[model samples]
Target: MLIKSEQQLLNFIKYSPIIIITLIAILINSLIYIQNEQNFEKDLEIYKKNYIESNKRLTKFQVEKAYKDIQRERENLEHRLENRLKTRVQEVYLTVENLHKKYSHLEEKELLNIIKESIRTIRFNDGRGYFYIAKKNGFSILHPITPEYENNDVSKLKDSFGNYLYKEIIDHFKTEEEYFGELKAVKPNMGNKKFEKVTYIKLYKPLDIIIGTGEYKEDFNNEIKNHIIREHIQNVRYGKNGYIFIFDYDGYQLAHVKKEYIGKQRIDLVDSNGFMITKEIIKQAKKEPGFISYIGSIMPETGKPAYKTTYIRGVDDWGWAIGSGFYNLDMLKYLEAKKKELRAMNNESLKKTLIISLILSAILIALAFYISNILKNFFTRYHERIENEIQENRKKDMVLYQQSKMASMGEMLGNIAHQWRQPLSSVSTIASGTKIQKELGMLDDKEFDKGMETIVKTTKHLSQTIDDFREFFNPNRVKKEVDTQVIYNKAIQLISSRLTSKEIELKSDIDSTVFVTYENELLQGLMNILNNAIDAFENKEIKNRIIKFDIKFQKECKMPNCDIKECSQGKEGYITITIQDNAGGIAKEHIDKIFEAYFTTKYKSQGTGIGLYMTYEIINKHLKGFINVENSEMKHDTQSYKGAKFTIILPINIEEG
Candidate 1:
């Protein structure tokens, strides 16, 4: 037997190369199969992760997009409702403001009674909104919703949430001039059921009453939200399991995929990681739309705890957060089944892959370097071209501005000529008289003194004229509190000679007390308008060349116009100056183009259109005031004629400090 075994071993060794090659092939096949199997499992895990993430993103997007639409609608309703309420309060303030101005001289008690009666009768928004008044001590003076509460002290009044509603308003006014805030109150139409309401309170200092208005905020939000829920929000759907859920910013669920969870408070609910999931959802939803992953959730299919990935967004208008989510475990089963099939196919592919591995590895390295060089050169050229173009455009703009200023200076010189003519003539006349007196041997001491004084005063007047013009044209960016009337007088003074020579009747109703900033700038702009009106008169044959100034001062207004008389009714503060002329108003076609630079409605010798354009810039850009021109028919002393009217409205007071 030993002899036979030894012979067998020798025979196996004789063919050992062939046997080893066959055995190695089998082992290599097994190793490749195992690696491919491991790779398929790894790929499946990656696919599962990607699949879950994709679902999370899609669900979040759908929920957030739908929530955004609902939120936008809610906001619009809130804005409209709030504005309606605010406008109602403002209108009351205006009426009170007007009455205060109108009855400023009346006895306090009598004025209060008249104002109270007027407020009680006034209604807005088709009688849905009304105004009321309370004293600083929280004494209800005139409440339309709660008449029983009227004539009663409400300093201790509290809302359903235990907030001291009336005391807050009164105390707020102790340190503030105006108050706009929220409060809780009962709705008359809702059977006195408490709802959150917005209130605007202002201390009417004249009557010592905290005047206010209130409207139920929740009622408006609900009406808007219900419309959205019915028409759009509820219909939103994404993946097989995805649906939007709604909750207030405070985490009170309004809508959910699980019907039983709706209307439940979940702000304090935590996930497996102990994170306040609902609170975080509400917080994130209130800002921009985003994704969040938390470990704990109640599964929609099983109604059991599981890891959930959610997407959330807030609807700011209704103070609600809306979101949707999916469970990771649901995706696991599909991934596992897919992985099993993929492993066998991968194992087969791996056997073929080794044949070309060396060839592919050599080509990839060369391709990467070539692509990197090309990208670098392309971006470098692109950046250079963009920067060069920007610099060229900036230079061109600077040149245009300089040319405009130069053109304006040429026009100012002509105004100066007109201004200097009178002073020059007076000085010439005084000198001629003095020379004649000396030549005729009648230059007595008293006569010499009088002639000398007249010449000196005439020369001084010319010097002052030059100073005023120089100061106006100076490029000084200084602002000071200047009376509106002073600026007007200065402007008229600059163009007075031209208006007189043209036989223009200048009538002014200036309230000299109102003050503002940018005195010289305002003067220059007014001068431009005045000069335009004078120029407009040259072609017309109208008899009365009347230029009128109607200036008014108000205490609480902005951007005054003809309609402001009714809108502000002198209840707000503003300064309005209307400079109009009977020069047969500008042609309708040319009115709109009048403010354009280099746009002229005159013979080339008569005007450079830059005057009005510069005037527009000065008033609008420099003084922060509004100036507008219109062609209208005017009546002066029973004579009706057409002309251009320029109205300027500016702030009442500007603080220099």
Candidate 2:
């Protein structure tokens, strides 16, 4: 049966590696696959985000460029109208100049009459166009309106903008051959309100007269604006299916590719998705320039609605809403392409991971086989080697144990000697001095009494110290009749200096003659508890540090949820000893392990970690007692303090352990 058990153990050791390595290889590959799958999902989302953001930025740029162009075109329209007026005035001036030369022999006034009659019926600029004649001396040769100024001082005329109309004209002719400017005048069948007009005049030097024609500036502005909307705005294009569109605040389309919709109210027009696209554009344009989005016309490339993101700006001066937009393509094809690339990358990664896993498994398997063969060879000679080792260890262990015992004894003796050195030296000095004083007949009674008292106290302390140390290693264990109060006093005396030095206050309700048994062991445990409390206060910076000690007789301990069977140890009654302190508290994480050997919260130099362990052993093993520790809160003098409490429960009716 032993051989079979050994064989089974050997079999397990020899074959387990291959199985473990295979499992590890499978796990590695599985992890790689899962990680790749997650990465693909993340990459897909990132691609979609970047693609849409890029297109949005592109459309914004295009729309802004178109908006600037519209602004620039509006400025250019003014200059365009000015040039047209200059050209038309030159044509009329030349035509009149030719007639004046042909009829120079006729009266100058008759030639002026002929020029006016020939050009009177011709009209342009929305029928607000007409020709006029003026003499070189600022006299109206042919006044188109206000015939009262036909032969009088026309220089006194003022336009609606308060310009000295003929004065400016005569002033320009004095230095220049022609004049082109803006002024105001009434027109044929027009109201007496002087309408603002653009006038162009040229000096006809042959007759000492000025030939000019004028057009209403308001009418010219409207014509130029309409021409721009029809020609330039309608033709402007950017990205695929991108175009500039214009609409009035009333939602009438002014310039759009949908020619049927031009000049028609489009507020009711909706996209294929039934979204009122024109109404939304107009609404946003009313507030400020901003971007709006809706489903728009279908894309020719893909028969789906090309989503439109349009930027609308309100030209409040013109009472028009101008906008341009670019369409977004369907993403199905783009995502399909990205998916193929992702698959290719995942395939490559998986191949690499598998190859590396296989290589690692092969190497591990080879090592396993080699080690198993060595194990078999080692097992064949194991009995003889073990026999030799057993003999050698037996000799070595005996030597080491004896050495360790002697070393501990030596340490104990050394401590005793070190402690005794100073007091023994003092005693020797006092005794020798007294003998010398007596020999010299100089020993006084008072001095002699003081020396004797010191000698007696020091000797008693040394004797008590011996009893304490002896109990630590005494081989013979027996129950002795003891005074429990004396044991408690001894424990208190050991740590009294520590408590004093650390300024830790002690409160005791330890009634005398409590049933504390195993005097030496209990003394050691109690001293350990007190010493720990004192040490805890060494790092505290509080002024009212306190440690409370209490002992009592009861049926069971104050531990309401006591797990220990109190009656099993002593059926008569129970004795409980509790020590609590306000040195903050034992850390909750370290509280459970506080009594375990070699477990301490202190730095290496400060604690050996054996104090609590020895206390636990003494109470539980030697005294047949139960011990527990926990964090507790207490109120003293109307002040709250948090600390740790250690409770020890012992059998009141004693017996040998």
Candidate 3:
């Protein structure tokens, strides 16, 4: 029987090797498949990173290039507008000079006829078809072809063109030089229609006079407006949503893609870009030329990102800005679409590459599986040990999370205790006083009413204390605008009893106008610092223990040295509150760690070492402000006392900090 069993075992081993090898091959194949999946994921991440970076660069380059192109176009338009004005002014000057020479030998009536005939020839030859001449003393003469302006004084006129011409004539008289330029105007006779008019002046030395001629701007070469309109269209065509427009220095629409907008008073348009065209551009137009970009809403639009990039250049002759811009979004969409397409193609290619990798991985896995079966039984016991270790590690993680929660709870509770001590004492004292007065039989009707009122007030205070604690613990409140004075008053009220108990004198220099944008619970944070100051003063034996709280409204101040991220630029105002105490100051080495959680100078039982840490969190993270500490000698009367002062500088407009 023994011989027969041995022969059977040998036969079993020979035939079952194929089956065992097949099972091991399957296990190895699964392991290789998992590894290949991980590799594909890593590759996809790399591809995405490369694709995003490339597209970001491309978009930035395109935006910069477009900005430059618009700048060049604006410069060209401004040059053309200036040259046109100069040429028109010269033509009028020469024509008027000839008329003066011819009429020098004639009498008043024949001279007038010659003057009238000369005006006709000048108006026809010069781009301005209708010409009007006004003397410095307010006499007006019109060309024979257009008799409307004859014998009219233009000095009292206040329209854009009239005002501009008046100023140019005065300047020319003062400088004794020929003055020529374009002025924006709205003529009353023309139904108050606005127009850009070219004005020219030449001195008549014999008459001791200045003769000023003005021609309706539209009657001149139309290229002045056309150039402006073309620039606007180019900028608008490249932009995303809105069209571009140009305005003269006086805030009159010179040219716009929309026909109705041309020659309109831009100041009346709610969303006009005229406000952004600086006075410097106008002032410098005659001396130097340049372009500037500004944030302004497109005409006839409301909402954010409704801004257009306006490029302005100085027109020397007209003293106007040849400005143009398109809506920002309109210019950005094309690049955005290109980026999206590139991202999509990258993702698709990545997916195909992953699929190919998976197929290759499957083949490698199949080969590995066949080789692994030979040793599978040797590794089963080790796999069980690893699984047990992983389970133990998970349990440890759960324990750590629980401990962290308990630590946070303990710290929060300590802060609550510090905050509530004063209110609770006030309630207790008021209750005891009420009872004593009633029991002593010394309370009259009025006195009894007063005592009862005190009790009610104390009860309300206790309720408020509870509410304050509840709010501090609740972390879901949204931030809103808050009055800084109210916050300071509340902190003073909360710490009043504590200050009394410790015999610490409280002083405040709070500003009433200081307002802040923050969550309500931020008041609790300030109270925490006041409470700590009270504790520090009480713990030490310094005489005349005092806590000085000052709230200053600063137009601009640096952020405090706390770990808070500044919420806005330092341009806006800030509420700076300084809480100072007259106790022994903290050591220099410990000041740096004062805001770190679980690090405190107080005894283990006295403090959880989280009050200042939580205060830092509230001031920095929640309030979007900063907190800092300084140790210096404080003077009370003639005596010197050393204590720590905590200064919190919070932005009044958090958005600008």
* Top-TM-score structure, candidate number: 2
Q: Model 3, 201-228: lDDT tens per residue? A: 6665554445555555565445534553
**What TM-score does structure 1 among the candidates reach?**
0.37
Residue-level error in angstroms, candidate 3, position 203: 30
Candidate 1 per-residue lDDT over residues 31-137, each given as its tens digit: 87788778776888788878877887778677757866775776787777667667777788889899988998999767877788898977654454578887888
Cα error, candidate 3, residue 81 (Å): 33
lDDT of 1: 0.74
Off by over 4 Å in 1: 1-414, 556-572, 603-608, 654-657
What ranges in model 2 sit over 4 Å off? 1-17, 93-111, 114-130, 136-138, 142-181, 184-196, 201-211, 214-219, 236-240, 271-275, 297-307, 326-329, 336-344, 355-657
TM-score each candidate. 0.37, 0.52, 0.36
In terms of lDDT, the poorest run of 10 residues in model 1 is 563-572
- Give the top-scoring candidate (lDDT): 2
Candidate 1 local Cα displacement, residue 196, angstroms: 65
- In the range 307-361, model 2's lDDT, one tens digit per residue, is 7777888877777888876565545557778989998999998999899999989
- Per-candidate clashes, comma-separated: 12, 0, 14
